[model samples]
Target: MPDAYSNIHLIVRWLHVIAGITWIGHLYFFNFVNVPLQGSLDDATKKAVNPQLMPRALWWFRWGAMITLLAGLTLFVLTYFYTPGAGFGATSLLMDADGITDRAMWILFGMLLGIIMWFNVWFVIWPIQKKLLTGKVPADQVPAARKKALLASRINTFLSGPMLFGMLAPAHYGTMSFGALLLALGLGVLAIWFSIKSSSRVGKPA
Candidate 1:
């Protein structure tokens, strides 16, 4: 029933979802589980745990992000660029329209957030992490590097839910009004911020 392009889209979408799950799963683990655990550790324990644990986790986290981004981009091109009749093809990033459709606006927003998150992971998080993993970071710089990575990771976690909703909402719910879109974005950001703040406080001593 599906054409070759349709079949390919299906496969790429599947890969995108799987890779995204792996990437975000590890992301949440780092922000929620490992960060708190590390906070509770003494210097000696952190020195012991990080050397063994962080490299392995980083490997999965970085590659998962790469795969997800690639696959998602491919799917976006196929669905939007190639198949302009699709709901997402209503607007171009370079072109200004009098009004944009709900589906197009949501997809564009999601893609923009995804791009920023990917950039943070690769350009920001991974580079700082590599310095730490290789011990090339100066003793004085370690805290700054760790904080940079943690903040970026927390920001990605904050963006993930809204990004996912933006990607899926058009297909599942058709289209949302502009007001509804704003409300969704606002609530999503607020909820994620609260979640990150709450999780960060875990494992802290009174």
Candidate 2:
């Protein structure tokens, strides 16, 4: 039988995964599907589609992000901070001779990326999107606002791959060698850079 803390952790972890999928799924939909489709549409069509479609999608996207972040943080705290007897305590790891294992390093990197993504969603993307959707953005400012949101969303999509690796690899594969871990990090960074560059050119004319 599982203890109370274990039960809570399990619940929170499940919520985290579910909410993450919702959030990231919508994100991919926006970047991969909606954006291209919007580019193909004329202004009249965009005006018709966006007011109806975007608000509904953005509602799911932002709320999914919020729920995922909350659940993930709860799980992280329950797993690392509260579970001293489990040998996974963050304090114990920090106090050990090695002082923060490679696994912890990967988790930290993933968490940092998650934090940045959350910030971008709430502070940057959501605000501009709200302005555009509500017709508050001036005509001259619309393109800039759209571009800003697009870039931030693209960045999140780019980071999602490596962030998943960082969060999951440690659990599945245990502590990787410093060199191997660095190689993985390098690959992740390169992939994100490539994605950002490619996404930037996606709807542009040849």
Candidate 3:
């Protein structure tokens, strides 16, 4: 039978996936759909629409990020420290005298990206979004604020591909060449581009 730790990890992993979907979905919506939509709107329309629209979306986006980060960290700890017994034990892989294994390296790499994304969500994107929503940013500063938030969100968007690969690849990624890794990373970014482009074509000629 799977150990309790494994069982718990599975549950948290599931939660992490669900929360991640929510987080990334809204992120894509913001970058792919909302930004362009916002651009076309008159000042009055934006005033009418954005206040109602962004808050509800941001509610999901920010909290989805929070839950995903928490669950992912929990899942990482359980996997990293305790996984040594059934998998390559953390003692051998992470705490050993020589160095860590590729799997551990990948997991840590993914976790780093996730932490950065989470930080961006809380500290950068959300703060600017709040200001814009509440009209706190000065008129001259509004463009810069929007740019900062967009840059942060786009960074998260691009990183997501590699982050997801890092999380999943370690299972089967044993000793893979760095070239292939780089290739996969490129594909991840391209996938983001493709998805965002596809979003524009999806239904609603209105």
Candidate 4:
């Protein structure tokens, strides 16, 4: 059996993978299944379907994201920070003794994306969705709520790719310069901000 240290990170990695798969799977489900169904259904059908099925799915979706974030962050700390002296040459890989600055750049990028997603889920998407589901939000607000949720979800989908690349690259790249690390971080943050900011503009109801 692995020691406690190894066991802990292993568990976190496993949880991260599991939760990430759950989150992305449902994301695809919403994009592929729910959105198309929206067009085919009548207004009454939409009202019923959305208030019931959509919210349930979103609960799983957002929590899966949360769990993934927690587990992934924990793993990052344990593997990169807690371990001493560049185990397996992780420092050499990052061009640092601590190995964290390089990894930090990637984690920072991922955290930025996760922050946007969290805001969307908790602030924009959930609030608006509540209105739509509960009919508490003014009829005027329903459209706005829906638009925000859809747009934010799409934005998350767009950010997923580059964020993953940045997070995984240190492991694969052997070593990265401060300049290259900075460049990756800048590009990741810019991509996230642009995607989310652009999403808000396109969805306002006419």
Best by lDDT: 3
Query: Per-residue CA lDDT of candidate 4, range 49-164, in tens?
Result: 67779778979888988898788777766765565534443433233666446555666666677667666666776677667777787877667767777898777766665666
Which stretches in model 1 have alpha-carbon errors above 4 Å? Answer: 83-100, 200-206
Show the colliding residue pairs in model 1. none
Q: Tens digit of lDDT per residue, candidate 3, span 107-172?
A: 777788889999999999999999998889999998899888999998999999888888787776
Q: Rank the candidates by lDDT, best first.
A: 3, 1, 2, 4
Stretches > 4 Å off in candidate 3: 1-3, 83-98, 197-206
Error of 3 at 131 (Å): 1.1
lDDT of each: 0.81, 0.80, 0.83, 0.68
Per-prediction tally of clashes = 0, 0, 1, 0
Minimum summed lDDT over a 10-residue window in model 4 is located at 85-94
Two-way TM-score contest, 3 vs 4, winner = 3
lDDT of 3: 0.83
What's the TM-score of every candidate structure?
0.84, 0.84, 0.86, 0.73
Quote the lDDT for 140 in model 1.
95
Error of 1 at 26 (Å): 1.0
